[model samples]
Target chain A: AQTVTQSQPEMSVQEAETVTLSCTYDTSESDYYLFWYKQPPSRQMILVIRQEAYKQQNATENRFSVNFQKAAKSFSLKISDSQLGDAAMYFCAYRANRDDKIIFGKGTRLHILP
Target chain B: DTAVSQTPKYLVTQMGNDKSIKCEQNLGHDTMYWYKQDSKKFLKIMFSYNNKELIINETVPNRFSPKSPDKAHLNLHINSLELGDSAVYFCASSHSPGLAPDTDTQYFGPGTRLTVL
Candidate 1:
């Protein structure tokens, strides 16, 4: 069984600054996928970014990027130039290449301070 | 158009009542899933269907039944809902059954917040 862990229960970042959310997972599979999903107060789940285990390079989408360290089983999300809209409950997820279920971690609520 | 949509964004019902939540995907994905987010914001998979066939059924209560009339729709019917069932349910779809890098990328719908009072 694969389990994702998000250590931070809540985080606060000043607007226009950067913040990083830590995530770690335990999985026996060598090849898998990692993802970060954000859920705002509207309750809409939006995919922020994703990374493939086979790729050593991390995944980046606009202001969101991931530090995917496969060896350490760490996949952290970095939000550059955080905006008020970025404040949300962010979840880190893991899925095996051949599996249909995605395991998610307890989300970290991000607060943007002006 | 919404890639994936769930009906009744907010469901408020009395305990012991039965209710159903509907989900549909317009992305033509072959696989659809149901997830429950508890009050603590922990998300867990409840059920999954691939092309109208039941694929993944987690350790959810039998009261929570999922029906799929077609590959594009998956509806959840809960019987005798309890206070513990008050959570946000999310519907998601993905083009899966393959090992493509993008195959398992799921598109989620605006969740349905179920409140059992």
Candidate 2:
């Protein structure tokens, strides 16, 4: 079974600054996908960024980018120029190509400091 | 146009009762999934279906059942609900390429909040 772990339970970033949330996973499969999802107070889950294990290039979605270390099993999310709208709970997830089931972390509460 | 939606955004029921949550997706995807988000905000996959056929069934209790009449809809019915069952249920869908296993993004619904009193 694959499991995702996010070390930080809470993270805060000053406005216009950068923040990084750490995530690690345990999986024996070589082909998989890592994702970061954001859920606001409305409880709507939004996809932030996704990284494919086969691709060495890290995924970048505008201000959101990821530092994926395949060897270390680390997939951290970095948010640059953080704004107030970025305040939400973020989750790290892992899914195998052959399996549709996704393993998600407990999630990290993000606070944007004005 | 709404892509995926779940009815009864919030539900409160007493213990040992039965309830159902309806979900529908208009993305034309062939696969649908049911997930539960606990109070601590831990999201876990409970079940998934492909064209109204059971694809994946997790270690969830038998009290919880999922029924899919078609590829576009998946409804969850919980019997004798318990306090521990109080959580938010999310419906998602995905479709893969023909004859190959490819990574497809899963679109999630707004989620239904179920509270067991």
Candidate 3:
């Protein structure tokens, strides 16, 4: 079974600064997808960024980027030029090519200091 | 337009009561899923349907049932609900199956907050 783990339960960063939320997963499959989702107080789950296991270039979406290290099974999300809107409960997720369910980590609460 | 939506944004009921949450997607997606977010905020998949066919059914209790009448709708019915069942239920939809690339993004609904007293 594949399991996603977010080591940091809570993270705080000042506005205009940068913060990284660490995540790791245990999986045997080499071909899979990793995702970072943000759930704000509205409880809407929004996709921040995603990375394919076969791609080594990593994935960047605006101020959000993922540092995906396949061999290390580590996928961390970096929020650059952080804003107050970046505050939310961030979740790290994993999905194998053959699996239908997406396994999610415990989640890390991000707090932006204005 | 609302890509994905769920009805009864908030639900409050007593134990042993039966309740239902409806989900619909207009994204023309072939796959739909139901997830539960517990009090501790752990999101877990309960069921998934693809093209109106049952695809993934997690190890959820038998009291919970998922009905998909069409490719765009997936409804969840909980029978004899218990206090433990009090949690926020989410509906999501995707365009392709699990193996397809560029289709892994699942759009979520506003979520139905169910509180079993």
Clash count, candidate 3: 0
Query: Considering summed lDDT, which 10 consecutive residues are worst modelled in model 3 chain A?
Result: A95-104
Tens-place lDDT digits, model 2, residues B6-111: 9989999999999999999998888899999999999999999998999899999999999999889999999999999999999998885343343357889999
Question: Which residue pairs collide in model 1, if any?
Answer: none
Over A1-114, each residue of candidate 2 has an lDDT whose tens digit, in order, gives 688999999999999999999999999999889999999999999889888899999999999999999999999999999999999999999998888888899999999999
Interface RMSD of each: 0.8, 1.1, 0.9
Of the two candidates 2 and 3, the one with more favorable TM-score, higher being better, is 3
RMSD from true fold, candidate 2: 1.5
Candidate 1, position B18, lDDT: 99
Q: List the candidate 3 regions with Cα displacement exceeding 4 Å.
A: B98-101
TM-score of 2: 0.97
Worst 10 residues of 1 chain A by lDDT: A43-52
Separate DockQ for every predicted complex: 0.88, 0.73, 0.77
Question: Model 3 over residues B1-117: C-alpha lDDT tens digits?
Answer: 999999989999999999999999998888899999998889999998988888999999999999999999999999999999999999999877544556778889999999988
lDDT agreement of model 1 with the native: 0.94
TM-scores of the first chain across all predictions? Answer: 0.99, 0.98, 0.98
Let me know the DockQ for model 2: 0.73
